[model samples]
Target: MELVFKTEDAISKLLTIKIEYFDSLQIYLLNDLWVHEMEGDFFLKEVESFKPILKRQLKYGLNPEEYINKVCKRIKEKLEFLEEHKVGSIEFLQFYCKQIKPITEITTFPSLGTDFYDEFKTSLKECKTDETDLYKFLVRFAEGNFNYTKYHEFSIGCLSYVIWNYYCALTELYRFVSTLQENAPFVDFSNLDIEDNKKCTEHLKTDIKVHFNQDKISVAHLFLFLLKEKHIVFDCKDERNNELQLKRFIEAHLTYLNINGDRVPIRSFNREFSEARASTKVQKHKQFINKFIYGLEQYRDSLKD
Candidate 1:
């Protein structure tokens, strides 16, 4: 996927916007804690160290409840702006980063970590300027050091360091949201019968057997004949041609067996079908055509008997 930001300035501005969002959220959480009277000395000390003004009870004579309300309003406005501009949420940013191949290297680093920097540098060089600029902006937003030399070489080691931290923050954000609510509603399977479930599954797996000679007439030839004769009509509403629909249906079902009692693999079936379909000799073969007709005649005769 193309990088979202086109220009370097746009990338920089996006990073600034994200940083402001993170800062706002942090402040909101601190005020929330203060309002609930849950702020301890250690918490206050940490808050002061991180951003001194948040220790409003001691350092600043601000009402925690008011701060929380104000922060909530500001967050709502920011969300509206994000919606309007299609700036995307943190999840979208993570997904976009994942789509970029080089960025994925940041997450799957080797255990040794020695060759990681060299690999990252090589990958970064091959990346588009917009991708690198966005990455560099994210690093800066995450409080990562991004030092570049006169020769346009970036600090690969620093890039790796900051990117790992940024990735971790994204992970923690997901974990935080996951903790807030259940992903799916609880279901009690206590009344279910295990034996019946097993029987149902086994019934579904039962294969449909058909008559044909694997050596004389390949599975693909038989499949094409059946489809052409309307013996295996696809129960689909798609506008795709019969060949494509049959291929997809066979692949999905995987329950058909050739006359030799061997499962028909989709890959081999496709190859055989392509070759057979393209050959006029195969289509016009008298013996081959007769074999299928003979089988159908025998089946019909047996039914009448």
Candidate 2:
């Protein structure tokens, strides 16, 4: 619905917002601010023409969390630099923040998710919006606008936008986060920089790549019923098949890694594999493929010695 560009720093009071929402939303905002400041046209156009690329990312890419994380890191670096350098002046920064306001004028109903996403695929066939050109306005608004509320609404649309591409990217379902560590890295808790969030989102996409590269559960369509949807399911026959396949694959891969003393590669793969592994359901077989690739690399390294 809008795109508001603003900033606040240590010298300047940071804009405060209540956090009961998703952390990614905040990260996205900060990154957006950064991207607009730096890449300007490219960034704006990205939001304007998001469908194709986002769709590609969702289909043949990495995990979303990982992508976002990298972006978060990069954006933080840039913000820190900007805060330290103050390319212009404190008055300018504060002025920038003061100048922009949220745009909430364009009101519209929610979009249909099912036709595009697996979970919602069968639930709704089409998304009906008002005939007042809300979608077109959104594209134009995202491309060049200075309204916070509009950006906020625009961001909500972004979530749906990202989800649609996600559906198009793969046949099955998956998750990028599970059993998060007690001390994970800190990310932008404010929705300040749109670019940072975009980069972070893009970086997190790799998890999907790791999945597809590994290829066991090759199912093409999956639906998520809850927030943490790791697409895995098994029947009586599947249990036996899984046990045998897993046993053979594990033995071969792990043996190669251990014997070759490729602990680094093996351990990394182990972590990735565990992260992707589902207790009750199945996902892409790419997990194992990644492990095998590591194993092979390690084996080749050992051969050199």
The candidate maximizing TM-score is 1
The 10-residue segment with the lowest total lDDT in model 2: 173-182
What clash count does candidate 1 reach? 0
Write model 1 residue lDDT over 210-245, tens digit each, in one string.
433354235566677777767877544542335544
Scored by CA lDDT, what does every candidate get?
0.35, 0.29
Looking at model 2, residue 3 earns an lDDT score of: 12
Residue 241, candidate 1: alpha-carbon lDDT = 38
Candidate 1 runs further than 4 Å off: 1-217, 235-241, 255-264, 283-286, 303-305
Clashes of each: 0, 62
